[model samples]
Target: MGTKGMDQISEKKRGKNKLKSKKKAEDVVDDIAMDDKSDTKHGKNKLKSKKQEAEEHEEQLKRLKETQAEFFEYMKEHDEDLLKFDAAEFEDDADVEAETDLEDNEKQDVDVAKKVNEQKTITAAMVDSWCKLIKEDAKLGAVRSILRAYRTACHYGDDTGDDPSAKFSVMSSSVFNKIMIFVLSEMDGILRKLLRLPATGGMKDTIMELTNTRPWKNYNHLVKSYLGNSLHVLNQMTDQGMISFTLRRLKHSSVFLSAFPSLLRKYIKVALHFWGTGSSSISVVSLLFLRDLCIRLGTDCVDDCIKGMYKAYVLNCQFVNAVKLQHISFLGNCFIELLGTDISASYQHAFVFIRQLAMILREALNTKTKEAFRKVYQWKFIHCLELWTGAVCSYSSQSELRPVAYPLAQIISGVARLVPTARYIPLRLRCVSMLNRIAASTGTFIPVSMLLMDMLDMKELNRPPTGGVGKGVDLRTLLKVSKPAVKTRAFQEACVYSVVEELVEHLTQWSYSVAFFELSSIPTLRLRSFYKSTKAERFRKEMKQLISQIEANSEFVNKKRACVGFQPNEPAAASFLEDEKKAGESPLSQYAMIIRQRAKQRNESLVESDVIVGEDSAVFGKNAPSSDEEEDEADRNEKGAAAFSSSWLPGSDSKEKEAEEEEEKKKPKKRKRKSQAEKKQVEEGAGEDDVVEDFVFSSDEEDDLFDIEGDKDEEDDVDDDAADEIAEPETKKTSKKTKGTYKTWHKNYKKTKNKKKARVA
Candidate 1:
């Protein structure tokens, strides 16, 4: 080797030396091979320990499994023996069928006791088997079938009037109650599925047939009893807030509503009897159930049920019961729903019944109850009226059914009649207010008019003897002495006014042209107008005083006028006199007079100077310029006079024309003078006509009484006119040149003549 090769080998040896040195450093720090050996050793130890533990656990499980199997086998054998015992308790189906056949054969032999004994034995055995199955297996289907079979045997026994043994009766009630509990427990599942199946039409026929069959009567009772018991349980569940499951079951049950009616009726009767006797909760439940039944069974069924219920209600005379009130209110609400359905005749009948109920409530209002009771009774009265109104609106027109308008009118009128004498003023007011509201909304003007007319007629028939008539009997005295006495005269008066106001308000808003036309013929307007005028006068006096105050305060006067858009005009008398004096004077007359006076003062000619004077005019004229000019001057004079006096012809004096002018002037003045003189006569005629017409047509007597102030105002106005006429003559001389100049001159002449006569006397 050369020196260079030796150097290369030395470098490579150094690199290899460095790598060996790094490996030695790493190995010295952590003993890498030893660490790996220890890790492998630890992993093997863990695996060996896990294998040993698995073997031990497996051996323990085998032992435990053997023991559990042995224990389960023993328990199974015990269950099997129990099942055998239960099976033995049940009469075999062959024996049961044979026994039924033997009983049938015995029935033909008239051996009723033997048949009863057999049925008792059979029912007892079957019930025992059911109890055992329920206790041991708890298979719902097996239990259900066994109970149904046992119930069927009891039903058959009941049909034959077979006397059941006490043991069997006890077992049957327990077994039935148990089955009911089981059914209720599974009701949500079973009933939902059962009801979801599409209905076949035959179920109704089957139900009808079962209802009619004497043999199935017992079955009917059993079914009803079962439902009754279940309902009671469900109610208890509801009270406890555990009703979710049961309510769901009831909602899905097909026969639940159908089966509820008979039971509900029975329950309602009993509940109503005990209603005030402290079973309100049960009564409430009965009401709710009946309401549900009405909703579910539809209108026809509900209507029939209500009719029967109403009879019972009447028979019991339970109208005074608050619970009855609640019950009837609920039934009324349900009937309202039925009214929304397609059946209209039934709804009309329902409305009629509601009216009857309202009448009963009206009577109850007179009862000596607490203030709250009276208030509630009043509310119920209005509620029933509102419901009846709604129901009537919902129904269609039917020929067989009388128009709902008349009955509703009567009910409202009856309440209106009652409210006045009702002890509570606020209650009376409330009832009357509701009547007014209903009258506004639903009452026809014709019916209302007729009702008002009838009331008025009754009033007339019952009116007290007046002074002119006899003995001066007032309405109070008449009512006091009447056979059927009036209650609450003040209330009756209030009701009358309220009803009148309602009628007026409705008539003002509703344009019943035909009814309005009929009313027009009856002379209600004069009476109504009189009432309005009287009422208006009271307002007018207040307003007049207010206006006078405002006028006294200039700022208020201006502000009020601005607010109300009022601008008072000049007084009529002053304006009339001012215009009258200037009537005959032309605009140009005044101007020409001013001009001529100025000219005369200035010494100028009134006429314009002409260039030529004609010889013919000098010969023929006294004051003519010329013949032709004279004619022209005369024509100008005539034209000027014509222009001023066109309203009256001149230069043609006819007696008839003069007399006509004189008559025109004289007649108007005379009429003005006599208008005041005739004032009382016109008023008397109008008043007499009004009173007689009111009596003839029998307009509302309240209106007649309230209208006195109005008639007095007319008389006052007449007297005021007479005063104005008396004052007219004193002012006549100052206004002599006016349009009434002739009348003014005549009045002045009469006054002067009177002064001369007084002086002579």
Candidate 2:
């Protein structure tokens, strides 16, 4: 029976081992499948460790599940553009009914699809939100396959005699499946083939000549016609639904243009060439597509775009060709858009791109596009300035910009100087917004903000200021300026708002004014417009707080600037203050003690100013002098200062300011002043509390006993100087000046000056 049981136990163990091995085998299979699915053609994830793969897998799954509901809701909420092309395509009277019925059926199907998606997460529904979708999912892949299959079937299959449901399915599937085909067209994809495309002998010869030599030889008719056709092709392609959709769709993919760098380079080469030579509408549309892509993809598209800038063949010998330069300014404008993207590229790339951008912009500012003294030039300069500021902020690190910071600043500052006098106020406001962004990024932007403030101050300097915005224009006048156009830039253009916003932003960012800290100092920063918005009121309130906070911060920073090394103390200052109080020191002395203690702890060599009040009791003890000597010295100094009291000296200001000034003065100088150490030596024997009291100056200067001795010492020095020069040792009564008054000394020694000079020499 024992032998049988052992055999049975072995059998059981084998069964368990087999099951564990099977489970492990299954896990391995699943991991292999995940890896296969996760692999990209670019090999971005190939170097990742197994752990990282697992982490990414888990995160992707979590994010997918999290956004699944959102995707469904987004499908339900989304409304596609009405198919007006079909409406225009169908015009026959008999076919109108069929088309209308088809359209109604399609709308009903769309609503039903939306309802179905609203209830569940379908991978097919997520394709439309392409800007955010990056990762590949098996479910989504399966859905795409299903849709493509249905679309292909509906296209080729006998349609059951034009079934409306069949039509709807074909259209819906086509819309989603078409983007997955890696779509490109001749207009967007033909850069490498441009020279190779079949052309007549003359055309081919001219194309090769222009391509090899210079951008200017395109003056020949054949070359001009070919170039014009290219421009037409570019505009047509940019406007096409498939190209626009596919270009935008690429940005959503995880690897972006990295997989298709070759294709992207081709697209850029073709686009920039057409953009340089194209008409206004053609050029604008051409760059718009590239701009939208860059803005969405940010730095992912930067390399390809930059590669095109150098190799576009639009420039000849480092300068944009004179013929092409007419509309080449749009290239600069396009780069401005690119530079504003949320750049994640390295500093080296940013530096290179910005340098290239400056070069392109220099050539592109041809005669037609020069930033002239005109209303439109303002926007042109605004674009360039914004580009530089955004590039520095988004791409370059602060430390990286430090070396080039001032030159870059001067460039932006120069543009800002032109903004105030800019003929167009709308563009001026844009300058304000750009400056606001620059201010948010660095301290270097404050000068630009100040420039705007000056412009704002001169907004109505030349023009006769209107009575106000709401005041009726005088119809009787021969030359009546419209409020919207010619009135105060503030009242007409809403110009003051941006100017004030910039000023407030810069001030709030850098140093705070006294007005900022004290609300009464700046009584108004808001317009009391009739029926104002809640935003205005809320902004005013927030502005007030912002100003106060900034001022308080500036004050705090200023206080610590001298001893910033000690500000972030190793120990919390509050604990030290508590300890000082525990040691029975006064509140005023406690703060002084904390400051000195923190200073010493920081390994800094301590000076008299850094010593705590109670640490040097003897110095302050002599400050509180004998009462009779104080009265006598006070009486003498009062007569001297009484003559000059009205003059605003450092300590003795107006009556109201004197109290505040004395408090400010006393705190810093408390440890520095010399007092008669002989009398205060006894205070060393007293308690910390007694010494703290002896040292602190009372709030009222008159009632203050601690600071009187310093004033008397200063007064005595003045008396000694005057007495030494005027008093004579010739007679006893003259030397003594019996009354011991400066007035009495002057009267006694009236003519003794010549006698004193002989003895002094």
Candidate 3:
């Protein structure tokens, strides 16, 4: 206990001392942390207070400066003479004389200003006098006074109080119209006089003519005021004719638009509004003026022009039908022409639009949600695809625009595949048509045989038609069938006919190529399979005819290809039938024409019947005539229209007789039985002719057919032989190598390669 206990005590004491020191150190650290926290809080608070005070001081100073400015402006307006001083007192005699002359001129200007401000109304005579002064002496004073009045009048109702600089006091509507018309009409001549240039000088000449002279400065201010106010007035206009008139006049002054960049942009915005929402005549004039501005201003305004025009087109094309389709087509053509003006510049905008479309499509594909799908599956988006397709292909021969075509085609293909079912057959057909157009223009082959063949396998085709006779839906105007209209025989017939027509078109586009046989083989075989399996006699007849026509075209191309002396490996072989003019029309053109005519006639019949039904409803409903005679007259008119429209259809005699019998008998039971019999006939395929079992190509032959060259995505320059090819089915092992290659082009490969290299490094 002596030594051991002593060591134990020493150890215990040391432990206690360490614990006390550690606790004290912890307490001191806590106190120091609290003090530092409080000090930082106080510092932040002081800094914030200082900031607030400084901000408040700056605000007060700003308010004081504004007050001083307002006071000075008031003084200048009320008693401007008091602001002037005699600075020439220290100068020589010549300077004094010159100052005296300047004072006299200032007095004259004040007199002219007073005279202008005193006039309350602008009459025709006053306008004529001003124009005469401008024309005779090219007077800068007249220009300034009139432009000031015009600018003030444009904002007539904007302010509550009067403006001292206004030349006119009360600007009536008629007076404003007169001044606006005069300014727009005479702007060119006035600009020419002010710039001291001839009529034929370029915009650069006009801009260079400006100097430090007083007249030039005054002219600049006046012209800007006139142009800016013109845009303001144009924005408020609702009259289409007047807008057109104004645009027509303003287009002549586009040469000077380059000088005022901001005002020019505002004017383009206004023009785009009318271009989208105006009447046909108004839109035409607006587009013409836009084209002029793009040409006149060149790169300065072209970007805005293209972007605005595209936006307007998208907004307006949200609801296009057969009636508005022609106008939309014209707008698209005009847009394409505008792009062609500067393909290099247009490439940037085109790439953006194409990439945007691709991104939206990618999102839709990724999420597969209705909300996401709705964004891409609309008339606006479809028209956007067509528009960019035309734009990209219009300049595809040029390297600047060629790269965009592939990406745009990929977007179209993605949209077609987004909702690949019978319900979206019309949409699929539309996308395929756009892809076909791109391929045709770019000398690249897109294997759309799968899309065409997919349409044939839809279960909607084999389903029996409903007994009720509904209105025929136009596939061109619809993306998908509605619930009520989906079961109708008219939609079924439309789907079948549209599929056949699109297939024919797809084949015809590549018929003049060297690989026409390979291109037509898969589509032809699938169509035959569909023809044999389908129950509709009308559909079978169409498919059979289409197959025969495709075969004849293939044989025609084979005969042509057989006579060629060049080897298959040579460029001459690739260039065979490259010149379409020399290749003449495809063999399927006549068949395509006949199909189109029948479709047109069918649409006419549907429209007329719809009108008749609508009129009949109105005659028997609340809008019915009060007398029997009026009712009889309406019935007669409807009958006449129905008869006239029925004549457009095939077998008009049978339809006329049926219509007459229906009119004679008011029995519902008889009509019901007649509809049942018609339904039975449709179910049985009553119009069946001889079924041709011998197909042009067997399944074994299909497998042995030459492997198509197809499109490759490894090169920027598209090959000539890559014009047309039939891709193998996706399930085949060979297809794995070729998967998506036909759908894509070589534009994006290099980009992805560089990105991968960067990531690896």
Off by over 4 Å in 2: 1-241, 244-265, 269-304, 307-378, 398-405, 419-436, 443-445, 459-464, 467-486, 489-493, 511-761
Model 3 Cα lDDT, one tens digit per residue, 1-761: 89999999999987786576556546645765775577568878664332343344345434533655544454466567744534343236545666788899999999987777556666657767887897788787788767866776566655443666544766544555556656766666677666675653355344645545566675676667766776776765555555666676667666666777777877888888887777666766676777777765678688988988888788778675655665677677767766865778898998888888888888877876656787787788999998888776667778998888878888888888877666577789899889888887987888887887887787667767742445667777667554335456877888787777767767777777777887778787888888888888888887888888888888878888899888766888767776652545667766777877887787666443233112222121223222111123355334333322211211223456678898868677788999999989887984344222111234442332221122122133221222111122434756765766744645577778889999999
Question: Which residue pairs in model 1 clash with each other?
Answer: 580-738
Candidate 1 or 2, higher lDDT? 1
**C-alpha positional error of residue 692 in candidate 1 after TM-score superposition, expressed in Å:** 42
Candidate lDDT scores, in order, read 0.41, 0.39, 0.67
Estimated TM-score for each candidate: 0.32, 0.29, 0.61
**Cα miss at 578, model 1 (Å)?**
54
Model 1: runs farther than 4 Å from truth?
Answer: 1-138, 141-185, 188-225, 231-288, 291-304, 311-331, 338-391, 396-497, 508-761
- Best prediction by lDDT: 3
Candidate 1 matches the true fold with a TM-score of: 0.32
Candidate 1, residues 1-761, lDDT tens digits: the string is 99999999999987786566555435532453464456468768764333343344345435534654543343355444521222232336546766788799978777876565564443445645765776577555554455444343234323233344332322343443333334544433332232332231123334444455564453444444445544544422212112322332232232343555665555444433332232323333343334444545556456655555445334433232222333443444444443432355454566566667655755545662333234333334455565565455434243323366456656565554442321223233333434444555554443344444334333322233121222111221011111111232333343344334434443332222212333433425333433343333433353243223222333322332344332234333223223322542322223334434643443222123331222121121122121111123355334333322222211123456569998899899889879977987887776233211101112232222212121334233222223444567867855765758788889999999999999999
All candidates: CA RMSD (Å) = 44.6, 41.5, 32.9
The candidate 1 region of ten consecutive residues with least summed lDDT is 476-485
Residue-pair clashes per prediction, in order, are 1, 0, 0
Clashes in model 2: which pairs? none
